[model samples]
Target: MEISARNSIKGTVKKIVHGSVNTEIILEVASGVELVSIITKSSAENLGLVEGKQAYAVIKSSDVMLAVE
Candidate 1:
């Protein structure tokens, strides 16, 4: 798929958590690294996301803030 985002990371779906309105997707980008994303339940179903499915995490943002406590 073609996308405008430059930070697209390819990974495999590791885990899925379904909520009433949203679904949490955990993608393993590296051997020990993962990214979590929350998307609409319908969208997740439409995409047919399941464990072991390959996906891309396309990040498009103007600013990313980091905080440490």
Candidate 2:
């Protein structure tokens, strides 16, 4: 994967929540932080996302708007 952003984190797919419309993919990164991404059901099916699969969570600092305590 191309590392265009400094906030990019690589991890494995730990769990997947396939909703009726959209699906949520959970990834476990090296720092023990979990990254959650929402994608379309069709995209999830096409990508064949499952647990224990390696994936990259590409994140940009600008995309992250807010964080809570």
**Lowest lDDT 10-residue stretch of candidate 1:** 1-10
Would you estimate the TM-scores of all the predictions? 0.94, 0.75
How far is 21's C-alpha from truth in model 2 (Å)? 1.2
Error at 63, model 1, angstroms = 0.7
lDDT per residue for candidate 2 within 4-66, as digits (tens), equals 677777799999998999999999996678989999999988988899998888777665477
State the displacement of the C-alpha of residue 60, model 1, in Å, after optimal TM-score superposition: 0.4
Each model's C-alpha lDDT?
Answer: 0.98, 0.87
Output the number of the lDDT-best candidate.
Answer: 1
What does candidate 1's lDDT look like per residue over 1-69, in tens digits? 888899999999999999999999999999999999999999999999999999999999999999999
